[model samples]
Target: MLQKAFKRYIDSFRGFSKEIWILALITFINRTGTMVLPFLSKYMKEDLHFDYDHIGTVMVFFGLGSMFGSWIGGKLSDKMGFYKIMIFSLLTSGMLLIFVQFVTSFIGMCFAMFGIMLIADMFRPAMYVSLGAYAKPENRTRAFSLVRLAVNLGFAAGPALGGLIIMGIGYKGLFWVDGASCIISILIFATLVKEKKLSTHENHEDTEKAVVKSVFQDGPFWIFLFGSYLTALIFLQLFSTLPLYHSEWYHITEFQTGLLMSLNGLLIFFLEMPMVTFLERKQVNRLKLILWGTFLLSLSFFVLLFDNWAGILIVSIIFMTFGEMFNFPFTNSFAMSRAPKGHEGRYMALFTMSFSLAHITSAKLGLGIVSRHGYTTNWLVMGILGLLSCASILYLKRIVAQSK
Candidate 1:
């Protein structure tokens, strides 16, 4: 029985192209080094002596940079191609990250954060478009799952290691490691992945059927993007406010908090690929799955209302992780499918922009509520937002059905 299970796990990884594997490798390398984000809020609050409002403002800058970076990345990918964009984004962002540790003042940190993220996040849309270029239509969703596996695997490692790094050398060490990782990951990509024009043949039929000339004209997609924004807004709390909660409320140490956060990535690493493969084989309705995932996300926050037991944190993360596994890969696949061949970068940019916008709102709104009301109030608001996200997606499902 164990042998059969292992074989199934192995089989789930089969049939991907060489480029897909290389992409996954670079993602893993990059993400494993990305120890800064999970710890950024804590660092600002504890090290720099910033208040919640200041931290929120800095994060707003971060998100703004991400939003603009995603937009330009998509446009430039369409013009200059994903390869050059990927190199420039990684290389420039790495240097900026290393420099960020020096900026101790609130205003300096804000501008530095913005600059780092603006260059950094350009990789997102370009990477999504690259998947469309590289992966086969039949296995595209699974391919997305594979890259997510790399990301989660990196997440699993990054925080745990980051915790130790903080314990040993302080937060300054995180900047060096994060910066080096970006450079290394890009160098690896530059070495292995050769530049190529997007193949028009694979998506020609879908492109032909596309009636909307501009991404703005795609009404249902806008609805979907809004739903995505809500989901992202709710999920991003894990990085921003939740870490503070772990320290303040639960009295968890940074190392312990890192371990708890690592659980999220570990769960996705072990379960997501096989589960996604099974779902693909079953050919389930993507929107239905997304709705269920959003509902789960709502429950994850609501579970925190039972704050009597520290164990509830574990249960809450489990719920969030499963919800993430269900929502994100399918979201990528659906968004990619909506793009006409030539305009892939634009469609993907808008899709990625939803998350960037959410990142902006998530920090400010969550921190504001925590400052004014409390953590419990914040969780309740997020739970309500998750429900609204579900409704938006359901409405999108109906719109799509009517369009068909």
Candidate 2:
């Protein structure tokens, strides 16, 4: 059964060359190493004894850096080509990581944080921008699903690997691992990643000014951009604040805490493809599926405040995981579908920017709500936000219909 399943997945993406697979694997490597930070925060606070404000400050720097990087990357990808942009960003980030380990002071760490995040996130917009050239629209969502699955598989391994590295060697060791992985990816990319450039293939103007106009010319582009930001901000609080809620309210151990996150990633890895297949077969509207996903995700956080043990956490995860299967891939597919001809990089860059911007804004908003009003109110506010996001999608869908 497993053999047949693997063969079928191989057959599905006949458009993608071996180079694309390597690109995907490189993505998995980068994401896996980067995913260590969420778990690293716990070590920083609990073991190293940093205060909450310091943690928040570090997050702020990371977010701001990523926001700036995404914009810069988008513009660069439109002119310089995807592989070039991605390689430079990754190598720069890796070099920064080597420096991050030496910082023991607060001010020093903040500066390092900004540099690391800026470079790490710069690669993302270029990465997404590249995808438009490689895969067909009908299979685009599936392509994203497979990519997410790859990242999740890497994500699932990363925390445990980080944990063991922390246990055996030290916290600094994690950064070393991340830096080494980035170096390896940079080398692989230089050799194997030659999927034709989005700009030259699409004949986008090679000038910087031209690339800037391409990203923001249309009004609806901005609308979807803001929508993607909201979607990311409202949903991603699960990683940052959820653990705090579980720890303070339920007093769960650090091990169990990491385990719950692993559960989220694990669920995505095993179930995403099957869920996407089911939705496709049902002829479900992608927009509706995403909206439903938003509701379920919001509901998960709201319901969790009432649970006493891990059981409730597990149940809540089921909702969020269900939401993820539809919410993540469809939104990405929508971004690709909506791009104007010959401007794939611009649209994909916008999509990446929106999502990256949300991470920055949500760090402030999600943390502020939970820190101020308590977990119950935090969950409630996020639910309201999620519903508002759904309304935006519904409005967009309606507008599209009226135009037709």
Candidate 3:
């Protein structure tokens, strides 16, 4: 019985190629260096002395850059090839981070954050395109989950180490470390990855037609993107609002907060792959997973309503991580499956844009609610949003089924 279980566990990783692993490695390295964004609110509040509104505005600027970056990355990946985009995003974003260390004024910091994220987030669409290009159809969900595993593993390390590093070298150290990781990943990718050939079979008329057909034209996908946007808005609260609430309400230190945040990644690292593998073996419906995931995610936020106890926070984090495991990997696979041939990058980009939209909106909206009502209000709002997203996703499933 144990041997059979072990065999099934190994089978989850069956279809990934050397390229997929290398890409996953690059993802791990990049995410491991993900020391800056998660802690940006703390740095702004403590170091720069920015208030909640100021931080929200800055985050919105960052979101603007990210949203534009994702859209452009998607469009450009189709035209320029994903390999070139990946190499450029990594190198340029790394170099840009060094400049982030020196910004002094509010406007200057906002612009710098915008530029950094614009370059940094261009990798999303390119990475998605690369994963789709590399993995087989039957194995695509597991492939995405594997890459997310690499990400979660890196995230597991990044914050815990970041907490220690911040204690020693201050916020500038975060920028330096983040920049170095991007550069290191560049070297690994450039050394190992051969440039992928773009589709060359199209005639002039077909090529012209392809250029005109955009990912936005798909109505059901638009609904899906909206639902994804709502879910992302709630999930991103972990980064945007939760840390601030911990510090202000619980008087938690930055290091402790980092440790708490790490719990989300750690839980996903251990459980996501195994859970996905088991669900696959059981042949679970993909749409059902997403719906349930959204519902659970909302419940995670609602868990925080019992905020009198520290233990409740831990429970909420665990629930949220389980929700993420259900939502993200399967959603990515579903998006890839929905892509019209030859436009995968654009489809992936629009989907990625959903998160970017969340980034832009969540911080500002969350901080506004916290400023006006209270932290509890923010959690309640997020829970409501999640419930709405569940409905949207259910509708999306119906649309997807009809199209099929």
Candidate 4:
């Protein structure tokens, strides 16, 4: 059955020709470096002995830079071309990682992560837009799903070994590995991938411009983005809050926390593509699955609140992972299908902003939830909001139709 589903996913990509495979390989390599993320904080905190507030400060700059970079990256891809933008971003991301290896102070570290994230996020939308442009309509969803699965495959192994690298090789070793991965990814993309972006500047020859006139000006796009960002706000807490709750509240080991994240990635690695292919073929409504997926994702937080139990937390995370499988890939595919005819770059750029904004607030929002209402209430509120995102997606659909 697993092999059968895998074949369906590949078959779905029948008309993609060769461009899509090259992009997938590039994505897989770039993401492999990122998989080291699950433990970077723990290393900084326990080994370097940084305080919680300091870590938050570091994340703030990272978030701010990412938002700015992602917006610019999307437009640049639309104007200049995906391949060019990716080459620049990939090369920069690796250099930034090497820079981060040398930074020690809070401000310096913040700048490093921020710089890398800004560059990394810029290439993200172009990649998404390129996939849609490179593949056939029927294959688009599967292509996104396939790409997601490839990302998780790297993520699954990267973190598990990251823990060992932190122990045996030290934190600097992990950074070096990540830097090398980025270099490799950039080289592969520069050599293998080839996708041109649309020209943004009509009068300026071929210079890139914003995908559309003030992309944020679109009412539906912003609304959908906000709704999605809200989910990311809650979802991101898993990294920070989950460990604290598990270690202090649930008494789960530090090692176990890392293991749990690997488990999440593992589930995503094996199941994501198959689930996407099957779900795409089913008669079920797309919006409904998105809502339910968000709902399940929020439920992962709920288990932490229940007597701070590890078992429940594990199960809840599984639920959230399942939900992620349902929402994220399909959301990209659906957004692409609904994008305005001549504004693919603008469409993907604005869409990517939702998650960027969320990453900015995700940690602080999660911490705020715990401080004000306690973990349980915050998780419950987030879960309810996840279901509501369904309503928002549906509402956006109506808005799009009205515009049409």
Model 4 misplaced stretches (Cα beyond 4 Å): 1-16, 42-51, 196-214, 255-259, 283-285, 299-310, 400-404
**Winner on TM-score (2 vs 4):** 2
Identify the superior model by lDDT, candidate 1 or candidate 2: 1
Residues 301-325, candidate 3, lDDT per residue (tens digit)?
9999998887787888888888999
Clashing pairs in 3: none
The Cα RMSD of model 2 versus the native structure comes to 4.5
All candidates: TM-score? 0.90, 0.86, 0.88, 0.84
lDDT of 2 by residue, 333-387 (tens): 7776666555655677668867777777775777788778877787788877877
Ranking by lDDT: 1, 3, 2, 4
Q: Candidate 4: global Cα-lDDT?
A: 0.72
Off by more than 4 A, model 1 = 41-53, 102-105, 163-172, 201-210, 244-259, 308-310
Lowest-scoring 10 consecutive residues by lDDT in candidate 4?
201-210
Best by TM-score: 1
Model 2 misplaced stretches (Cα beyond 4 Å)? 1-16, 39-51, 199-214, 278-283, 305-310
Model 3 segments more than 4 A misplaced: 1-7, 41-54, 197-212, 244-260, 306-310
CA lDDT of every candidate: 0.89, 0.72, 0.83, 0.72
Better TM-score candidate (3, 4) = 3
